[model samples]
Target: MGVRIQMLVALTSLLALFPSLTVTVAVMSVDLGSEWMKMAIVKPGVPMEIVLNRESRRKTPTVVCLKENERLFGDSALGVSVKNPKTVYRHLQSLLGKKHDNLQVKVYQRCFPEHQLQGHPVRGTVYFNSSLETHYSPEELLGMMLNYSRGLAQDFAEQPIKDTVITVPAFLTRQSEGQSCMLHRWQV
Candidate 1:
């Protein structure tokens, strides 16, 4: 009878020691490449390290497609490019800097700025809109990619995020590159 009572007490104590674990869902975004973005939700109440990636219905691509028919496609454009390499564009981060007027940007050709301000050269391609009236700037283009990723996070959680963190490389600096921006404006 004593042993039975001790076993019951031990089981009750064990149950009290460790309660059931509940995890919350939080959206997390990661820059897979400079151009591509990935987003997933992390379990809440746990450190940011515990988040697992939820497979997306579509893997977003940075590339955008313009057709003579005035039809446009972004991520889906990649699949159609193998047959016609001339219509595909990739790795536009290299063309973000100033370029010489004589520079000719061709379809499927990587665009690069003629001048290299810092150690990192600015490179990106300019894409044409359906209206053919406006040209997209490299900075603006890249910003759209970033915003898209943020949207993914917001959409998954169905809530706005107050606490956010962005990861940048050690060498990415506007000061070293002689570019004037928020990073350069602040004298760190």
Candidate 2:
């Protein structure tokens, strides 16, 4: 009887010590790659799961399309890239928080012939100009992609996810670091 009581007490103390073991929260991890983006979710007592987009793909192209009335992201953006090259922005990771004259910006312009790049007046940050008239900053475009990934994670987890962990490349410049901070703030 004493052993049984001691065992129960020990179990209760362990549970109290690790309350998170009892309760589960959904956390989404985003791999913000330059060419593609991916999201995965972790839930208590379950293995980490990869969240797929609407097309049932594990990875999504990092692209955004701006139409006159609406904005499309990922596959939708890529779909219109050929038809509306000037309005579809791709390879935005290189332009975020970068100067207009940066060598990388010039390279991105050459690589992604579908989009037009310009510099913001005050910040000198790179921006994409759509065919219609809207100018989208790299941060804003990145925000759209992040939101899309978050939506996918939410759909898979069947709950609202508030915690997100974003991973970036190791060889990132100060401008890229600033862009990551901006993205972090946007998520918050």
Candidate 3:
């Protein structure tokens, strides 16, 4: 009983010393579909939903590209994929999780590994362009996209955002799959 009391007193003292500390929570909502990637920033009291860019626009297509020059492209890689459909890459969200196996992604003519590439397989891995080209792991691609989304949220908040809460769809099952949705609160 004495030990518990002492611990409580110490905690109280620390709280008193840091009484001005503020705990800010951020929620990044991401929804990646075959056609578009949508994200939103959520705060404790804010009611605005901000759309993110796909590299150069207000939104990014749920697409990717594998360049022969060892470059991975998102939607901007679309042009290249269009010119050389065999080299450009796109659409990988549906390949993750339970939906990965015994499934077909005809909307985008690309293939993903049937097994887990990283810790999670919900985001699934893909090959972009030529066989010799360097392919991006699903985690890396999702990380880059979410990182961009976090940047946009920081710009909107106009403050250094460290604490955040991210929201994802119920079906996502990859480590990085839902991360892009939580770019702002990734640290937590």
Candidate 4:
């Protein structure tokens, strides 16, 4: 009983010292990289904690698979890449906001020759071509990934986490492309 009282007093003192540490709701942050994505969550009475995926991994591969009518994300999608190279999309962060003629897009094309990538007829930007005969823009693909990450965060928090912050790769931010989505005003 004495230890419990002391612990409560310490917690109260700590909360008084750092008011922000007393979080009442859960919030999540995602680091969306080219090869992997990591998520962290902050909840009441807890410090920032890495949100693990279903596989209990701190990070998830940044890959998505779109086959027929089904779509897969992360490792599940990566697992199917060897069998269906044309349907699985990898390193999508590199393709984000790139033009069809951009040097980066050229590099992406060379990296994944198995999949067909074409310029959007109107946007003149990169669009992925899969066996589904449907074209998906990088923005759409990134949105799907963000959604996937949200699911992971939600599962870990065990509550609906509506507040989320997503950050892109450093290279993406330091790129010379000015006509791209830098996410300065974009909110998750």
Candidate 5:
């Protein structure tokens, strides 16, 4: 009984001294890739842990499906790609900030016929066309994937997540780098 009372008093004193102290349980690191994306979380005094999506996979397909009023991502989006090709956007990272006539964009279009790409007024911006006649900007499409990744990290950590470090290729061009920064800013 005496020990318990002493511990309680000590905790109370600490709380009083640092009433606004907030403990962060985890930090997330995301590898955003054209073909796949992966997330890992690190907590103080613990080894880094990979966070899996609903499909129980460490890496998720970088795909998004736009419906009339909602969006689906990862495996769910890939599953609907065949039936709803026009509405499913994939290879977001590769297409981001690339002009519609870019060689890489042309290659992607040839490789993935299910989706259509269009040019935006911005020099390196591209848009995806959906069945609803809605055009999704590269940033918006990548944002959806990032948001979904954040959700996975939150779910795995069992806590609210607010920050992440995304990994991009070092060989990206200036335009690509700018677009990547724009995406990061949107997450913030």
Candidate 6:
């Protein structure tokens, strides 16, 4: 976090030298991990800091539980998952972009054994049969998580975060990386 702050400070200083130019920007970086995800921001006028979740934690559990009509994320979702595992989705980064029958996804399914994993007959990607009997693709679930992360970052920065760099697992296929809105982004 300090590393980005150094560069951001320089940018702000340059702006100070030139009072005629007005520019404001904030960049967020996300580490999309299987077990936990972290977020940080580089915004002018303040030191770069890790974005905190609702619980004010540095890192949030990579979990989401859709219980009936209510939705939960991070620690709250993990707590609900303990009782209603079927409504919870975990290891989202690991499952994204992999074939439904891929060995890695198979291991995840066998290890978790909470939600029912099935392959889309056409897409051949993995989707979970939630407790509500809704079929949710990994990409869709990940999008929810990313949206949640975006909210956290935006709230912390106190402004809209337009440019974000999300770091993905090295093992993810190109398709998985492409699934997100990353036309001008990359993993790591």
Query: What C-alpha lDDT values do all the predictions have?
Result: 0.44, 0.80, 0.53, 0.77, 0.77, 0.82
Judging by TM-score against the true structure, name the best candidate. 6
lDDT of 5 by residue, 1-188 (tens): 99999999999998899756668667888887777989998876779999989989888998888877778998898888768777778777777667888888889889887777778776646787653557778777777788788889989988877667778765455555455446646332
Error of 2 at 53 (Å): 1.0
Candidate 4 local Cα displacement, residue 121, angstroms? 2.3
Q: For residues 1-188, what per-residue lDDT tens digits would candidate 4 score against the true structure?
A: 99999999999998888757444668889887789999999887788999898789998998888888898999999899889888888887777667788898888889888878888888777888764557777777766777788788878888777677667767664332222223322234
lDDT of 2 at 42: 91
Please give the range of 10 consecutive residues that has the lowest summed lDDT in model 4.
176-185
Higher-lDDT candidate among 4 and 6?
Answer: 6
Task: Report the lDDT tens digits of candidate 6 across residue range 1-188.
Answer: 99999999999999888766656878899988878999999999888789999999999998888887888899999899778888888888788867777898889988888778888889887888763557888887777788788889999998888887878778766577567545333233
Which tens-of-lDDT digit does each residue in 8-124 have in candidate 1? Answer: 999999988996675444545444344554445454654443222233444456654434444223456566565654444445444445343214433223342321222113443
Model 6 regions more than 4 Å off = 1-23, 131-133, 182-188
Model 2 residue pairs with clashes? none
lDDT of 3 at 30: 57
Deviation from native of the Cα of residue 173 in model 4, angstroms: 4.6
Error of model 1, residue 55, in angstroms = 6.3
Top model number, lDDT: 6
Provide the TM-score for each candidate, comma-separated.
0.46, 0.78, 0.52, 0.77, 0.77, 0.80
Per-residue lDDT tens digits of candidate 3, residues 28-146?
Answer: 55555555666667666778567556354656665555445554445676767657665443445554432223334333333533222222245444422233434444444555655
RMSD of each: 10.5, 4.5, 8.3, 7.9, 5.4, 9.3
Candidate 4 to truth, TM? 0.77
Cα lDDT tens digits for candidate 2, 101-161: 9999899888877677888899888887764567788878877778778888999998878
- What does candidate 3 score in Cα RMSD to the true structure? 8.3
